[model samples]
Target: MKLIGSSTSPYVRKVRIVMAEKKLDYRFDEESPWTQDSKVSESNPLGKVPCLVMEGGEAVFDSRVIVEYLDTLSPVGKLIPSTGRERVEVKTWESLADGVIDAGVLARLEATWPDRKESERSQAWIDRQTGKIRLGLAAMSRGLGDKPYCSGIHMSLSDIAVGCALAWLAFRFPEIDWRTDYPNLARLHDKLMQRASFAETQPR
Candidate 1:
């Protein structure tokens, strides 16, 4: 398998961390969808990063879909529950984390789109996106409470997703101060960063 994505993408990092945790081996083909010469569109019609090409030339796009598939490949460290309400809870946490990342990405693009005129940029839009991020963080902190992991006693896909989202916010929006705003989340992020998977996949 070959994973095509830029190191800076939180979604890509999430997939990488999952693969590492599962002890799966794959080639990393670094590609930025934003670049003019990027072939991301060939694998993913949405022109997104983290496209996984399997041995038979089959393509799996979207971090959520790819990670779930990868989890089924090996039982080294199961990240998602196989069935029941536990699965739904873990997936919900993942969705919340991804939503935060989407907001952050949109806010960053609005603030830094090169071709857009200064007059055309909407501070209101950026504010709205950032506002969502804050609200999402609050919800995460509330849901997490004092739990070591997001979904269960052990680290699930939920933890990985939240960790990636928090790391990306710190990387792209230093002014957010999520660490101070939500200490429980900060504690979770700190614990996750100690893992080799999380440490090795830190965004450049």
Candidate 2:
């Protein structure tokens, strides 16, 4: 099997964390879809990454699908509940985390228009996305409350998704100062960082 993605992508980090938690080893092919001649299109028709190519030549992708598939590979550290409302809760957490990252990614792209003057940089668009990130963080902190993990006592896909997103923000948009704004999130991010899966895959 082979895992494909850029090192800094939060979505790719989610899939990598799951594989690491499951103790599954596979070849890593670093390919950002944005680059010319990138092989991501071959594995994923959508031309995005975190694509997992199995030995049989089939590719599983985007981050959510890949993590769900990896979770079933071993029962050792199941990140998602198999049934009941618990499953829905975990999935909801994932959606929130992923959505926040999506907003951040959008803001990042829009803010990078080098040719655009500062006054023409669409501050409104950037503010909208950043506002979403902050609101999402607030929701995550509330959901985590006094719990040790994102969804109850056990670490799940919820934890992985939120952790990756927060870490990516720290990497790309350090000026945003999210950690200080949400103390609970800061604590959870610190706790998740202690895990080998998260430690080894820290964004470059």
Candidate 3:
């Protein structure tokens, strides 16, 4: 098996963390789909990162799909729930976390447009996205409260998603100071960092 993605992508980082948690052995192909020389398009028609190619020549794209597939490989340290509302809750949190990252990534791309006019930059749009991020963080903090993980006592897909989102913000928007406003998130990040999956799969 092989994983195709860039080191900086939060979505890729989540898949890497899931692989680590499952103790799966697979090769990593570091290539950003945005790069001119990327080969991601060959494996995935959508040209997305974090494409997992199995030994049989089949490829799985999207972080959510890859993470779920990896979960089936291990009986222990399951990242997603087996059944009931717990599964839905974990999926919902994952969606929220992904939404935050989506907005942050969009802002990052818009910032790099050298030819983009000031009027086109749209500060209002950026502010709207940032507001979504802040509200998402607040909701996460409220739901997390004193819990050790996002869904319940043990680490789940929600933690993986939230942890990846935090790492993404820290990497691209260091001046945001999310930790200052969300201490619960900071604490959760601190605890998650202690794990080998989070430590080894950190975004560069």
Q: Whose lDDT is greatest here?
A: 1
Q: Write down the lDDT of every candidate, Cα atoms only.
A: 0.95, 0.90, 0.89
Candidate 1: residue 159 lDDT (0-100): 95
Report model 2's TM-score to 2 decimal places. Answer: 0.94
Better of 1 and 3 by TM-score: 1
Clashing pairs counted in every model = 0, 0, 0
- Point to the candidate with the largest TM-score: 1
The candidate, 1 or 3, that scores higher on lDDT is 1
Arrange candidates by lDDT, descending. Answer: 1, 2, 3
List TM-score per model, in order. Answer: 0.98, 0.94, 0.95
Off by over 4 Å in 1: none
lDDT per residue (tens digit) for residues 47-143 in model 2:
9988999999999988888888888988888889999999999999999999999999889888985667777778899999999998998899888
RMSD to truth, every model: 0.8, 1.7, 1.4
Error of 2 at 66 (Å): 0.8
Candidate 1: tens digits of C-alpha lDDT, residues 1-204: 999999999999999999999999999999999988999999889999899999999999999999999999998999999999999999999999999999999998998989898999999999999999999999999999988888868999999999999999999999989999999999999999999999999997
Q: Per-residue lDDT of 114-160 in model 3, one digit per residue for the tens?
A: 66876678777788888888888888889899888888888899999
